[model samples]
Target: MNITYDWNKGVWSNLPLGVKVSKLHKFNALPVQFSGSYEYNFANAAVVPEWSVNLTVKLLFPM
Candidate 1:
């Protein structure tokens, strides 16, 4: 997700787009992951906040 607006510092901004909810039901292999994120900020009447996280592990070549 991404939203933004800035008209002469009119204040508005946020971004949080993460996906990978346990990665259920793999088709070939490599099924395990997690994702996270958070962000926000404004101007003129400014406010600020931001955060992000990502975890992964994909090693599939054993059949």
Candidate 2:
């Protein structure tokens, strides 16, 4: 399974100083992997993106 998401904030400045870009992605596999991104403004030199990792746990049920 795979999933992706994004979010943006409203404009709060004439220079678009309050602009925000975010992204979240995930994939279901052995060890679940995920990544998160964050960026502001339109300057390629001022971009900030982050990544994350997650692991899936198995649960056992008893009858």
TM-score of each: 0.24, 0.21
Residues 13-41, candidate 1, lDDT per residue (tens digit)? 55344443444345566553434444333
Instruction: Provide backbone clash counts, one per model.
Output: 0, 0
Overall lDDT per candidate, in order of appearance: 0.45, 0.31
State which candidate has the highest lDDT: 1
- lDDT, candidate 2, equals 0.31
Best by TM-score: 1
**lDDT tens readout by residue for model 2, 1-63:** 122223354422212223223333334433332333332333222232222233433333335
RMSD of each: 8.4, 12.0
Instruction: State candidate 1's TM-score.
Output: 0.24
Candidate 1, residue 51: the lDDT equals 44
> Candidate 1: global Cα-lDDT?
0.45
